[model samples]
Target: MSAGMAGREAPLSRWTLLAFAFPAAPISAMGLPLVVHLPPFYAGSLGLGLTVVGAIFMLARFWDVITDPVLGVVSDRFETRWGRRRHWIVLSVPIMMLSVYMIFMPQGPVTAGYLVFWLFVLYVGWTLLTISHISWGAELTPDYHDRSRVQGARELLLIIGMVCVLALPAVIELANPENLAAARVASMGWFVLILLPISVAVAVWKVPERKAPRPEHVPFGQAVKVLIENRPLRFVLLADLISGVSGGIVASLFLFLAEDVLRLGKFSSALLLCYFISGVMFIPLVLWISRRFGKHRTAAGSALFNAITVPLILLIPAGHPELALGAFLLFGVNMAAGPFLFRSIMADVADHDSVQTKQTRTGLFFAMLTSTNKVGAAVAIGLSYMMLDVVGFVPGGENSAAALDGLRAVYVWPATIISAAVALILWRFPLDEAQQKANREILDRRMLDAAAAAVETRTLHPGDAQSSGAPAD
Candidate 1:
C-alpha cells in the first residue's frame, strides 16, 4: 500500500554488494585473530599476569561499549560529499592500520603501563572503524534479501582476511626462525598496505550511498527514549550480546587449548588457519540453507549444531593433534553458519527500526549491536582470565597437571554458557520471516511518504530547489 513499496528495483550488480562487503573483510580478519591470539601472546610472550591481561582486554572493550554508541549517533547525523558512511570508512582505514601495527609491534619494554596504554588506543581505534563500516553496510539497502547478499559477501571476505592473519604468524616462524619476528611485522604491514587501499577503493567506487533524512528537531533525550522503548530492538540487542559473549569465550580460549592441551606448538597457527578457512568454505552452504529455510531458522539450526559440535571439542584428549584439527574443522563449519545468519538478522532488525521510527538510524542500530558484542567480549576475556588465574594457568611454562586441568575447565565450562545462549536464541528471537516481510512493507511506505513530502516542499519553495541534486541536500 505504501508508495515506496509500489515498485522497488533490486540491486543492479554484485559490485554494489561488494562495495559494502569488501571493507569489512579486512577489519574482521584483523580483529578476530587479534582478539583470539593477542591475550595469550601478551600473557606468555610479554610475561603479563593473567588477571592483568584480562583486565586490559576487558577495559578496552568496555571503553568501546561507551564510544560505539557515540560513533553511531555521529555517523547517523553526518552529511558529506564522499557520502555519510564512506568518508568514515576512508578515515578509519589508516588509523586502524596504525593502531594494529602499534599493538603487535610495541616500541618499548612490555611493562604493564605501556601495554595498557597501547591496548586502549588500539581497541578504541578498531572499534571506531568497525562500528562505522558495519553501519555503512546496514544502510546500503532496505531490501531483505539484498541485505543478506551484502552481508554474505562481506562475511566471505572477512573469512579470507582471517585466514591470512591466522596462518601468517606460524608460517613466518616455521620458514625462518632467525627472522620470525621481522616476518611477523612484515606480514601485518603488507596486509595493511595492500588490503587497506583495495578495501577503500571498492567501498568508494562500488557502493551507492543512501541519502538519510535529517531528524526533525528531535532531542537527544528523545532519541535515547525511542531506542530504549523499542521492544524488538531491545530483544535483538540482548540476544546478540548473549550470543557474542558465548562466542567470545570460545575464541579467547581456543589458542590456549591448541597450545597447552593439544600441544600443537608452532603448528597452532596452521590449525587456526584451517579453522578460518573451513569457516570460509561453508559460507555458500550456509547461504544456501538460509535461502531455503529463512534466516532465523537457519541461525537456530546452526546454533543447535554448534551446541552439539563445540562441546565435542572437549572430548579430544591430550596428544591427539589430528582429532583436535578435525574438531576445529567441524567447529568452523558451524561457526560459519551462525555469522551468516546472524548478520542477516541484524540487517532485518535495522529495517524494522527504520520502519518504526521513520528514521534511518543504521549507525545507532549497529552501534548498539557493536556495544553488546564488546560487552560479550569483555565478559569472555575477563572471566576466562579470572578462571585461568583460579585454575593455576601458568603462562610460558611447561604445563603442570594442575594448569592443564585448569585449561580443561576453561574448555568445558564455557559449553554450558553456549548452550544457554542457543536456547535463548531459539526461544526469544521474535523476528521471523513473516514479521520481516511486514516490516519491509512498512519501511517502503515510510520512504515513499518521505519522498512525497520532499516533492511537495520543493513545489512550495521553488526558488530554493535544484532539478538535479545529490541526495544529501
Candidate 2:
C-alpha cells in the first residue's frame, strides 16, 4: 500500500467508492435529457408557449441555486452515527425520485402555472440532494491521487448515466410506435424509481465514512468569515465559475443546433446520444493525458482546442453535414477532460481548507462550488434563450437561411467563452504537484507535533510538575 493508503486500507474499498459514484451518473445524466429537453418538449408537444417554458426553467433554476449552499452548510454541521453525509443520501433519494415522477407525469391539459410549480419543487429538491452527495465524495479520501481516482470514477459513471438517458428516449420510441411522449415519460419515471434507490443504497451501505474530528465550537459567523478568508479556495471557486459557464452555454444550446442547423428532426436526440457516447469513450484517455501533463495544462489545452473547433464547426456548409458532426465529436473529447480535472482541483481546495482551519468542511466547500455552478448554468441558459429570441428564431417552425445562420452563431459563442476560461486557468490556479506534496508533508508534521504537545500537557499537572513527571500514577 502507498503512504496515503496506510490508515485508509480498510475503509476505502473499491465497492464503497463505486456505490458513491453510481448515483452521480444517473443524476447528472438527467440534466441534459430532462432539464434541457423537457422545456422544448413542453413548448412543442404540450402546446405551452416558449415564453412560459423558459420562465419555468429560469424560476426553478433560481430556487435550485439558493438551496444548494444552504443544504451544504446544513450537512456540514450534521453529526450522526450513520455518518454526516449518508443520512442525507438515504432520505433525499425518495424525495428526488418523487420529484422526477411529478416532473414527467403531468396531469390533463397542463398549464404554464402548473408546470412552473412542479419544476420549482423538483429542481430545488434535486439540487439539495446532489450537492450533499458530491460533498460526501469529496470528503471520502484525503490523498491527492486517491481524490482524482474517486472523482474520475464518479465522472465516468456520470457519463455512462448520461449516455443511457440519451439513448433510452429513442430506444423506447422504437418499441412503442404510437405514444412517443408517453414512452419518454414512462422511461424517465421507471429510471428514477428503480435506479435512484439502488444507487443510494449502494453508496450508503458500502462507503464507510471516516471519523471526522469533532470541530471546535466556533460561532457560525466565524466559520463563514474563515471560509471567506481562505484565499486559495476563493480563487478556485472563481475559476470554476468561469469554466462552468462556458460548458453550460454549450449544453443549453446543443438541442437548438441539432434541430435547426443539423435539421435532424426527432433524430436530433439520437445524434446527441452519439455525441455523449463519444465523450464517455474519451474520458479515460483524457485522464491518462492529465497524469502526464498535469490537470491544469491538460484542461487548458482541451479548452483552447474546443474554442478553435467551435468556429470551424460554424464554417461547415449545409452541403456536408458530416463536418459538423465531426466537430461535435471533437467537442465531446474536450468535454471529457474537463469535469474530471475540475473535480480534482476542488479536492485540493478542500485539503487546503482542512489544513488551515483544522476543521473538515468539505460539505461547505462543495456546496459553495455547486452554488456557483448553478449561477453559471442559469446565466448561460437565460442568455441563450434571449439570443434566440433576438435572432427571431421561431420554435418548431421552418426557418429562413438567416435563422439557420443565427443558430450557427450560437454554436460559435460557447467556444469563444471557453477560450477565455482557458486564459483564466493559465494565469490563476497556482498549486502544482510539488506544491501540494510539500503542503501535505507540512500538515502531517504539524498534526504529529500537536499530538505530542497534548500528551505532554496531560503528563504534567499544575503543582507537582517535575516530581510527578518522574513517577505519575
Candidate 3:
C-alpha cells in the first residue's frame, strides 16, 4: 500500500499527538498578545506613538530574514543524543522567557530603544523555537493526510491558547477597568511565564523526534537553486504570505477596531474570545473537509469565504457589541482553515524535495515558510499603522468621524482583497496526495537500497570472496 494509505491504516494515537502539540498553547498565548494587545498597550499606556511602535516591530521582523534560514540550516545539520530539533527548543526557552518578561513587564520608563532591543532578542528565540518545532512536525510523518492531523492539532491548541489568555484581560477589563493596558500586559506576561517552560518540557520529554535520512550538506548556491525550482513551495509560500498579511492586519487592528471604530472598547477582548472560540470550534470541520476534498481546495474555499464576508464588518453598527460579536463569529468560522492546511501542504512539498534532491531539507523549507509569514506580518503592521497615523487616528482617544472612516477602511479592504488572492493562488496547487504518495514510495525504496548495500558491504569484504575457497576453515 501507499504511504498515505499505510498511515490511514495506523494513524498516530491521540496521546502521542497531544504530547507533541502541547507546546503550541503557550507559544500562541505569547503571540496573541503581541498582535492584539501589545501594540496598543505600548502605544497608549507606555506613551510611545503608533508609528514608532510599528516601525520597531517591522525592523525586528526584518531581522528574522537573517536568523530564520540560518537557524534552519544549522538545525537541519545539528544532531544530538536528544535529537536535532528538541535541543533547539530547549535552548530557546530561556531566551524567550527573558524577553517575554522584559517586553511584557518593563520595569520603568520604556523607550523605543528598549522595545527595539528586546524585540530583536524575542524574534531570535521565536524563530528558533518555531522553525524547530514545525520542522520536527513535518518530519514526524510522511503521509499526506496524517500531516494535516498533526498541524490541525497544533492550530487547535493555538486558538485555545488565544482564547484562554484573552479571558484574563477580558475579566480584568470587566472588574477593574483601570490601568487596563498595564493590567493586560502584566497578566499576559505571567500567563506565558508560567506556561512556556512547562509546555516545552512536556513536549520535548514526552515526544520523540522521528529519524529521517541524514541530509547531504549542499552548498548555499545549489541549495538556493533547489529552493527556487520548487514550484509547490512557491505557491504555498505566496498563499501563506497573503494569508499572514490578512491575519496580521486584522490582528493588529482588532482592538483598535473594537474600541475606537466600533465603540466597543470594553467588549474588545470578549469579541476576540468569541472569534478564537469560533476557530477552535471550526477546526475539526475544516480538517474533515480537507480529508473529503483536497487540502488546497478546502483552504481556497475558506479564503474565498473570508473574502466574501470580511467587507460586512463595515456594516456593524457603532456601539453594538452583540452585532459586532456576530460579525466576528461569521468571519472566524473559516479562520482555522488556511494556516494548518497550508502547513500540511508544505510538508508534502518537503517530501517531494527530499525525493528529487536526496537531501532532507524540511527545516529549510519550513524556515522559508516561517519567514514569509513574518514578512507579511511586518509589512501589514508597519504599513497599516503608518496609514492609521496619516489619517490622524489616535488610539484610546476621541477621534473625528473622518478618522473613524479611515480606520474602518484600513481594517476592511486590504484583508478582503488579499484573502481573495490567497484563494486564487492556492486553488490549483500542484502537489496532491497521489504525488506525495509517489514521492514517499521512492524514498522508501531508496532507504531499502541503501540498507542492503550497507549490509552487503559489511558481510563481504573485498578479500573475502578470493579467500573463500582457500580459507575453508
Candidate 4:
C-alpha cells in the first residue's frame, strides 16, 4: 500500500478534524446570507421583484449543472504539490471574496444583469471551494463511525457560524430599526468576508490532505456510465434532492413567513438564531444516534421526525414570536442530521465505486450530490416565489387572508411531504458499515498486491530503479 493510504482503519485526532472542519464555519456562514437573506434583500430592498430574483437564483444554480461536475472531474484528476483538493480551495477564496463584495455590498444601482452576472461568478467559486473541501473529507478516513464524527464536527461549526451571523442581524435590529434589512444583510456579508480567509487558512495549514490512489484514465463516456450505474449515489442524490427542496423552500421563505405571516419582523433573525443554535446543541446527539442506529436509519428517523412536526407550525399563533421560536426549536432538532449523515454516506458510496472501478471518484460523486442539492434549491426558490406571487403575497406589505394562507401553505406542505419521501428513500439504505468495511478490505488487498509487484520489479531492475531515485542496495 502507498504510505499515504497505510492507515485506513485508524481514527483521526479530534484536533485534526476540527482543523479540517474550520472552513465550514465561513462557508456555511455564506449560505445563510445567500439562501435566507440575499433573495429578499435584492427583491424587496433593491427592487428586483420576486420573480426576477427567483429566476436569477435558479439560473445561477442551473449554471452549477455545468461547473459542479467539471470542477469535480478536474479536482479528482488533477493535483498539485499542495494537494489535489487544496489548490482549488485556495483559488476559490479570492473569487468568492470578490463576488461576495459585489453581491452583498453593491456599489451602484444593481440590475438583474448585475445579479445574474455576479451570482454565476459566485457559484463557480462556491462549487470549487465546497466540492474540494467535502471530497477531501471523504478521503480522510475509511472507518464508518469516524466518518460521522468528521461530518458532525463540520455540521457543528456550520451551525455555530450561522448562529453567529444571525446574531448580528438581531443585534442590529435591537440597536437600529431603520433600514434594517440593508444593515442586516450587509452585516452577514462582512462577517463572511472577514472570517473566510482566516478559517480557510487555518484548515489548509493544519489539516493534511489524504493522497487518494490515482484514478486510471477512463473515457468521459465510460466515466459517466460508471457514475450513472452507482445505486447508492442515486439514493443519496434523490434523498438529498427531496430534502434540499424541502429545506430550501423553508429557508427562502423564512423571512416572509416570520415577518408577514407571523408578524415577527426583525425578531425573525433571533428566531433563526434559535433554530441554528438548537442545531449546534443537537449535532453531537445526532452523531451518537448515528453510531448506534447506523447512519441511514438515523437519517431516516430525522426526516420522519421533520415530516411529522413541520406541519405543526400552523398551530403557532400568528402574532406570537415566542410560539414561533418554540416551533423552530422543534424543527431545528433534526437540522444537522440529514446533511452530515448524507455526506458521510456519500463518502462510503465513493469507496464502493472505487472498489468496483479501481478509481477514487470522491470529488465526482460529491459534485453530483452537490449538483442535485443545488438543483433542488433552485426548484424550491423558483417554485415558492412564483407561488407567492400567484397568491398576491407582497414582500414588506400588508397581505389579505387568502394571501397569508397561500404563504403558509407554500411554506409547510411541500416540505412536509418531501421530508416523508426522504425518510422512505433512506429507510432501508443498502450500504451499511459492514459492507463498506469489506469494500475497503478489497481495495487495501489490491493496493498490497500492487505494492508487492512494484517492489519485485524494482529488485529485478536495480539499475532502472537507481536512475528513477530508488536506492539500489
Instruction: State, as a TM-score between 0 and 1, how close model 4 is to the true structure.
Output: 0.96
lDDT (tens digit, per residue) of candidate 3 on 1-473: 33233334467778878888888988899988888888888887888989999998888878998899899988888899988899999999999999999999987779999999998999899899989999898877777888999999899888888888999976677678577778888888899889989989999989998867677676878877878998998899988887778888988998888888888966877888998899989888998999999899999999999889999988998989889989989878988888888788988998888877888878888898989998899999999999999999988788999999999999899999998898898897998878887888888777667766755765667466446543311
Which rank order by lDDT, best down to worst? 4, 3, 1, 2
Candidate 1 — which residues are off by over 4 angstroms?
1-7, 179-186, 464-473
lDDT (10s digit) by residue, model 4, range 1-473: 35335536679998999899998988988888899989999999999999999999989988998999899989988888988898889999999999998888887889999999999999999999999999988888877888888888888888888888888876777778678788888888898899999988998999888756677776878777877888888889999987879989999999899988899866787898989988888898998899898999999999999999999878877889888988999888988999999999999999898887778788888999999999999999999999999999999798999999999999999999999998999997889988888887887777777778888988899999999998864
Cα lDDT tens digits, model 1, 329-437, are 8888866766656666777877676666667777878888888878987988898889887887766567688788777767666665675576566556777767877
**lDDT (CA) per prediction:** 0.73, 0.71, 0.86, 0.88
Please give the TM-score that candidate 2 achieves against the real structure: 0.88
- RMSD after CA superposition, every candidate: 2.9, 4.6, 3.7, 1.9
Clashing pairs in 4: none
- Per-residue CA lDDT of candidate 2, range 257-351, in tens? 77677766676676677777788788778778777877677767776777677777666665355676676677777666766777777777776
- Per candidate, the number of residue pairs that clash is 0, 1, 0, 0
lDDT of 2: 0.71
Q: State which candidate, 2 or 4, has the greater lDDT.
A: 4
Candidate 2, residue 111: CA error in Å? 2.5
Task: State the weakest 10-residue window (summed lDDT) of model 1.
Answer: 464-473
TM-scores of the candidates in the order shown: 0.91, 0.88, 0.94, 0.96
